[model samples]
Target: MTASGALDAPAASRPMPSLAAFTQRLRDRLIMQEDPATAAYDRIMRRLGISIGIAGIIVGGVELPEVAEQGRYAPAWWTVAAVVLAFGWYPIIAVVSAVSGPRAIRFVCGCAAMSFLGALASIPFGLKLHTVDATTVWPFRVTALAVTAAVLAWTSRVTVVYLLTAATSAALATVYTVSAVTPQHVTENFLRSAGLAALFVWCGTAATGAAARVDRESAIASRRAASQAAAHSRDRERARFAALIHDAVLSTLLEASRAGTKSDVLQRQAERTLEQLDECRGAQRDPDLLDARSAVLFLRAAVHEINPSIRFATRTWPGYDDLRMPVHSASTIAAALTEAVRNSLRHAAVPGREVRRTVTATVSAGSIRIVFTDDGAGFDLAAVSADRLGISMSILGRMRQLAGGSAFVESQRGEGTTVTLVWGGDGSR
Candidate 1:
């Protein structure tokens, strides 16, 4: 890639990279490294845990007084035990069996067992409470129903059938308990319980469907990204290999074809072939390996296409020789500087005269900084509009995206401009 276009395309010719592509960029963006399925599941579990805790607290408090008053029949301790196990089950097991293959099945079975046995134990006591005081203690049972639904929604890797089955168990428990305790309003109580069960099942089904959609989309995006990345890598490698062949192998082969069998010519040709082989090997090394010197060389080569009138100068900090950096970072810095230098050549000029520019690089304890300065007419930053995105996007934007990197621009009319690109080892120097 050309130096100017490496980090960003010319804004005038093309729009900035789309958000999808920006987010999907290889090697530095975390989106490429994260699994969306895992993230979505974590969110689901967190929401489920929070909702369960809140529901348990509210319902348990509301039902506590009635359950406590009827201690002769519905012992307070047993009610507390059921509440603790019923509400706390999912939150505990969700964490413990988070990655377990049978977690969904276990959760479904557990919810059903809790609702059934809990209703059986408490319904008789609730009937006694109603007989004595006409008061109902169904909050604990209702809370169980709601929490079970939430648990089902959260851990629903199993088919919708499991949710339906749990909802059926909860409905039957509610109907049995309500019908046994309050025979006069059996229909109303049964409908309420069945409605709650149906509502929860519907909620669980909807949540499961939504989560499945997210997982599906994430999987598709990941596969597409991987396929595209592989294809792009192959294309880039092919181009680089072709360049190596043209620059070294082809030239040497052509010379060998033209030269007669003179000893000197043959000897030189053989030496060139060996050198070419070495270069090919070097090219195949880790592509990101780069040093300050090499970065400067790349910057020089990249700027060679600009007008020759504007002179380019580069210098390194003393005693900090051979500053090594990630190849990707080095390339980004080089590209940014190349753009800065070109901008200087194009805009940093007197009415009819060229100006000189300098690119200085300094290495410190854990960071590197490069500054491009030129003595040319500089425009006001505020006067620039959104459409003029070259410096804003191609240079500053790209630098900011690099890990622990930042870019700044300082310019005043007649005083010229200075664009600084700095990168540190842990995002700060």
Candidate 2:
């Protein structure tokens, strides 16, 4: 067995790794180590949270004096504690959530809930929180609207309804807390506070929803690309296997049948066919690259194996002998060329007519080209059936599967036939 095969056998038989192998994965993500699956959503949420936190800090700083002035109407300790809870906690949590993970997000949600509840609780105690009068507006009232709306941005529709209900109730309570409540005052304050909350809700929901959709679509596209690559790889392997059977095993059987079972040439060919099959079974390692000289020699041996009488020639440009290509490309071209020669040998030899077959391989700095010509009983290319896999799958499809590889066939009824295979520069067409 090959070294790679020996190593892979043990790995393939081993059990899957335990869940403990991934324990640090969450910690890594909390520190901003991105997971490709949720990268888009995480990026959007991180930026949104940081922006809202910064905005909250700015609003809190601007409203500090008013908050302090309103403290006279409430207990001194309650006023200081409420200010910290309503204004200080959430913004810090929101900013830290960018690196802190889901618990920080939950804390921000708690802050939103507590701010609305605190406004309602202060009414019975004569705290006058969230009250709007001729001279002053409650600072907590304004900042609470922002904090609650920020939560709504990332929450579900059901939670949105619940939070909005709490906000509306708080707005109504603040209106009643005014010394002389009027229908006009209640309607105006209710609409202003609730309307601003609704606007933030709508904007936040839309932005977050769009970010989620982007992440979903990106994951789908990634899966589809991977599936397509796998399918192409499978198709290439199938083509290579089919070519091997057609060129080596079948050809050996035909020669053995024509020459007698006891023939030495038939025995040798059968042994070579068995060795090729064994190699194919273990061909799991990465293929080695082939330089120009090595590729030419390999092609010459391949052609001679099929038809010893066929003329073969090689032409290499100066300073291009060191040019290299993937081994798969070389193998694909060799298989296609051999298939073309087999087709010529089977169909071109007419009774009482001399047939000449030649293969020419040309190597340049950026490309490799091979031409196969036969001066024999040529057939029309248009009359060939689509199901004739010798031409379609083995020769054409095989080369087409290789990157930057192509094949062409040209023939006329009374003239000659030419099969051309190319790789690299100008081969895409």
**TM-score for each of the candidates:** 0.42, 0.52
Residue-by-residue lDDT tens digits, candidate 2, 9-74: 232233325562242222223322233345455555666666666766777787777767766666
* Candidate number achieving the greatest lDDT relative to the actual structure: 2
Per-residue lDDT tens digits of candidate 1, residues 1-429? 001111111222233256833422221121111222353443454444445545555655776665565444555666666565454443454342332222453454356445534654555544442343432344435533553544453444442344444445544444443324544454454455555655665665566567667767755654453344334444655686788688767877787788776668667867877886787676453334344455455545445534444345565566444354565665566556666775666455555444556666666544677777776655456644443346666678778888877898876555567888887755321
Give lDDT per model, in order: 0.52, 0.63
Q: For model 1, what is the C-alpha lDDT against the true structure?
A: 0.52
In model 1, residue pairs whose N, Cα or C atoms come closer than 3 Å (at least 3 residues apart or on different chains), thus clashing, are 288-327, 404-427
Give the lowest summed-lDDT range of ten residues in model 1. Answer: 1-10
